[model samples]
Structures are given as C-alpha cells and as structure tokens.
Target: MHGKTLTFLLLLISIACLDLLLTHCGRSDHKQKLQKQDTVLLTKHWESPIPHQEIPEGLTSISAASCGTCHAEIYKEWQQSTHAVAFQDPQFQAELKKDNIITCLNCHTPLQNQQEFIVRGFINGDYKTPWKEVNPHFDKSLQLESITCATCHVRDGQVIGALGSDRAPHKTLKDPGFLSEKLCLGCHNVVDEASPQLVCTFETGDEWNANWAKREGKNCISCHMPSTERPLFPGMSKRAGHFHHFPASGIPKFKDREAGRLESMEFTESPVHPGYSPGDLLNYQLKIKNSFAGHNVPTGDPERFFLIRYQWMDASGNILKEEVHRIGEEWQWHPVAKKISDNNLKPKEERVYPFTQLLDRAGTYRFRVEVTKHRMTEENARYNQILGEYPLSIEVYSKQYEIAVE
Candidate 1:
C-alpha cells in the first residue's frame, strides 16, 4: 500500500511539471505573436498616405543638381560636405560590405513620403522598419548624392526653410524644426536594440541636449552650419543664411576641426626628489587642454580614437623611453564589453598625466608629445580588414620640449 502511494505521488508531480511547461511555452508564443503584430502595425502606419495636395506644375521632379543651377554658391559648399557623398563614401561602402549593414542605408539614402513627399525618419514616432518607398521623382544618376537638397528642404512641391518668402520660382514653406536640433536627431541619435548594454551607437544629439549648449540656446547648426551672406538664387539679393556644408569632424574640409585646437601643454617637475639626479629618475606632470569643439572631441563613431604618444630621447635623438596614452572610448564586441575605457576630452576640458621614468644614463633629454587622430584602433582596423587600406591617422598635432640635466 505504501509503494502504491509513492507511485501515485510521483505521477501527480510529473503532471504538474508538464502543465507548467506547457503554460510557459504558450505565453512565450503569445508574446512573439504580439511583437509581430506591433511591427506589422507600425510598418503599415509608415506606409500610410499623407493628406493629398495638388503638386505645383513644372516642379514635378527636382534634384540637387537642379537646385544647384539656381543656388550655385550653396551647391558648391554642399558638394564638399560629407552629406554629398553619404551613399558613395568609400569607408561607408567598405563597412556595409563587411558588416552587411542593410539598416544603415535607410539613413544614408533615405526615402520620401509618397503623399507629401517629405523626408521620412525625422521624428521619433516616424522610425519604422522597411523604410518608406524611395522618392519616385529622385534622379537615378544622382542616387549617390546621399543627403541631397531635397532631403531636408523640399516637400510637396515647395521649398522648406527656417524662414521663407514668396521670392523663389516655386512655393515656400517655413519649418521651425530646421532651425533646431530636432532636424538632426533622427540619424544622430541612434539606438541599437541588439546591444542592450551599449544601446546608443551614436548620441551626438543627446550629448548636445545634455551639455550647456542647449541652455545657451545653441543647437547643432550653430557650429556645423555656420551662416554666411550669399545669394539664394542667381541675380538675387544676398542674405545671411546657413551654409550647406554641414562640416563635422571627419570630412576633409573640417578635418582640423576634429582634433580641436591643442590649447597648451605644460610640464612641471615633481616636488619630491629621490636623491638620484633629475635625469636618473625623471618625474613630471603633463597637462593638455582642448580649446575648441562644442561637443566631446572625437564625438561620433565609437571606432574613432585619439592617441597621445610621448617619447623621452637623449640629445642624440636616441629613444630612451616611450609610452602611449589612448584617449576616446574603446570597446570590444566579441566578448560583448560595452566600454573597456573612456578617457576622451570634453569640450574645453583639460587632462593631466603624471609620468615617472627611471633612466640608465644622465644627459640632456627631449620630451616629445604627439597627438594623432585615428579612424579606428589597430585591432578594429584588422578586424574590419581596412588596416592600412584607408587613411589611418589623418590629423596629427605634436609638441616637443628640451630639458637640461646636471
């Protein structure tokens, strides 16, 4: 009778476990189904038609080149910008091929809303998968013109701007967002759901908001799209308006701006001496300051880095000691580390490094400090197979000081 009781208890326990397992599986399946439904709903909303409007005649199809015909000066500035070659950039092309980054293309070569024909993906709610259809009127030959004139300024057969007048060949519409950070957040504030720990792949817009720039009423355009007095159209009146270059760190026209100005480098001897000669046991403090840049230096692209290399050499130029201090955030993906170390400089921030060196001989020595901007770390470059294939250290700033010892 006791043996039968034990068997009956075992059977009851097995049945309970089976029931729990089935319940858990059923909930999981339901959750997945709901997620799918949400995605479908969002995608449908993205494809929905905008309010109908009669497009102006003779303005059916317009391209950046076509705009350039009237706005020649603005066109020249934009031609040299990173936005001009957004889609055809070699680095972008290589990265796309290496990582198979299909999602990035939407931001690089964006589509337009079919009804209003405005650029999509500007607001937070506008973010959707299977991006809106490519602009039907887009020129095939100008496909490489990544953020073209129409990307931000054209909508529904009308030219949009911060302020518009009835002076152009086509209708004009005023958009306040164009004058603020709202226009830049869509692409600049990217969140990678796959990287739960490092969800923000790029946070320039967020950084701007957090910094004093927002308090001072300064926006991304304050520094990036500086205004100049230029003619908007051929034989038109010159007016103070923003340039189209939109210069940022990496582009050639703004390369020097990336590193910011190295304000000052000072070396001070240590107060305490170890009885040995100054040359025998060297101790000093090195401080470097960044005078420019509204945001953090080397702000975008986690792969980009700034390296500070210091070398102690004898009068004969023979290296006695060398050390390298790497600034900027360093991350690893294989082991899934969000950030290994971040020593990057903030705008107008100063960083100091203390050094102690033990030398074998005593003589006149020279301390050389070289700051270089690298597109990516050696490890990242090797992983991407782009090491030495592209521009590695395009901008380098250096300083050297000679020290005498008894």
Candidate 2:
C-alpha cells in the first residue's frame, strides 16, 4: 500500500513539470509572433540607412516640387494660408526670436532624411519666390505648406493610419486606427504642461476634443479639410474625391449656423452733408453691428480679433483718408477697445454702432466699412487656431462728387 501511494505522488509531480514546460514554450512562441507583427518593413525608397535622398542643393529644393506635383489643390490652399508664410509673418518672426528652443519648428518644418531630430524653417516666407531672400539649410519646400498627408499621416516612415485614429501607435486599423481629428491634436493641442495660467491658452485641441467629442462624433479634418465634389483632377470629367476648401464641420450654430453667427452688412449713402465745399472737410459714417455671437466678436480664442477699417474715397475713386478700430487691442486711430460684458449678445440679438471717418479735400467722398478678422500669433498661443485673415466686407461708393473750396 505504501509503495503504490509513493508511485502515485511521483507520477503527479512529473505531469506537473511537463505542463509547466509546455506553458513556458507557448509563451515564448507568442512573444516571437508579437515581435514579428511589430517589425516594420522599409520600402524600396529606403534602401540606405537613412530613408530619403540627399535633397539636392537648390533655392527652393526638389522635395517641395514633388509634393506640389500630386497635391496641386492642397498646395494652392496652402499658398493662400498662413502656413505658407509662417516664417514671413512679421508677428511670427518677432515671436520666433523670443524662443530659442527649436521645438515649434519640428511640426512647423518637415524632416528631410527621416532623421527625426533636425529642425528646419522656411527660407523666409516666400511661397511664390523660392530661395531668393534665401534662408537656406532650412527646408524651403514642403515645410512651407502647413500640415500635409506625409506630415501627420505617416509615422516612422510607415503609413500606419491617418489623423483621427482611436487605437494608439501599432494598433490595427481593423480596430479603428488614426482619423483626421486625432491628427489635429498633435500640433493644434500643444500645451506647456508646466505653466500656471488662469486658463490654458495653448490647449485648443484639448478644448475642442472635450467639447465636441461627447455631443457628436467629428474629427479635426472634417471641418478644416472639408471635401467638395469637383470634376476629377485636371478636368477628367467624372467626379472624383475632391476635399472641400473648408474642412471643418460639426461646429455649433447660432440658432443653426456655424458658431452662432448672425452677422451681415449693407451699404447706403447719406442724402448729402450740409456746408460742404470743394477741398473742404466731408464726413461719412458706416454702420457696423454684431447681430449675434455667443461670446465676444471673435470668440473661443482670445487672440482671434476683429478690426473695423473705415475708408473715405473721392468720386474719382482715390482713397483720401482711413481710420481703423481694433477690437480687444489698442489702436492709435480709434480709442475704443472690445467690450466684454455679461450682456454679450446671442443669436437674434443685434448691436449697431456707426464707424465714422473724416476726409479733407474731398470731392464726392466714398465711405467703406470693413470687418476684418485676424488670427494672430498671440491668439495662436491661446486657441491654437492657425494664423489667418478672414474678412466680412461692406462698401458704399458715392454716385457723384462736388467739393467746395472755402
């Protein structure tokens, strides 16, 4: 009886050992499979240790031309955008001098040889003319264009996924990889993570993500890189996928339009100014009002601003005098600043104010009022919105002119 019991115990121990060994082997095999899946295969273009070519020395360089070849429309949009003129923006240049760390340039400029750490700049804000006011060694080509497909779409020389992906790096797209909105977070959502600011100024991406994600599902590119149906490239005749000029959507409406906007303008001339003479002073006033906006004139980002430009022109269409008023900032021409109040108007609420300017030596003065919106560098710091100018314009030209000399 004792011998049988001992034999049973030994056999059970041997079986347990075998099971442990097999389990270890299985784990080893699984690890190897994961490693293989993670390994990235380089393309034919990346034969050398470095992925890209030397990028021959030239004023504009060859790489930009390559991008321009396929993305003509994108390039055209970029040309009109401030990304194309980032380096040349007088304000950007001023601010760039303040920061020595080249970190901002990393996204602003593209890498040449896939050598991750090198920072570059546009050879001086010249999109049309390359390399003339040459700031060489800095990338003159593709870098001038803001964010591109290759910029955010490709990761580590591999096309993992596009911008708005839910799964992180190395996750399978079958499970929903990067999408357009996710791509925007990289640059647009830059934060100091080390500052004690009242409101985080540099967290546009984070703010938008928090606000929009819960309400409805939309990505950054959906609004900014919106698509429109155009004839195929180079006029193929059949309709193909043409991205829209406005690539942003899902923005809250004023009643129902974008960002609760109810702004409009019209021009009308006065009957005539009394006691007017040739080469004498004439006064013209333009009425501009913000009918409806949730917050301030240019809400969300504090840096976004509106300016009223009043131009007085003579009957011959010669601009005689001009005065400008900037909202939320100090301007010499006008002494008023943008007002922030609890009673700020919402959709359907309207406020009218007259923009007035005086012209001397006027002969049938023409009055024009322009509402100019600018996304400047300071605003970019706060809202992470790109630097651009948007204008809502209204003009009134005089039918005939008579200036009386005193």
Instruction: Give TM-scores for every candidate, taking all chains together and pairing residue i with residue i.
Output: 0.71, 0.43
Best by lDDT: 1
lDDT of 1 by residue, 356-400 (tens): 777556567787767777766667667666565555665456667
The CA lDDT of each predicted structure is 0.60, 0.40
Model 2 weakest 10-residue run by lDDT: 125-134
Strongest candidate by TM-score: 1
Let me know the TM-score candidate 1 reaches against the reference structure. Answer: 0.71
Put down candidate 2 lDDT per residue, 1-406, tens digits, no spaces: 4674365445435434644765777765754453344322222221112223332322123343454565477556544443344444444444444432233344455444322333221112211111111233444445554344445433343433333334232222221245555554555554431112211133445444444332455444544554555532454443334352332212221122232123422334444453465544444544444332212334343444455676667666688776776644322211322324323222233444354443444344555556554544354434433233222221212233344323
lDDT of 2 at 203: 48
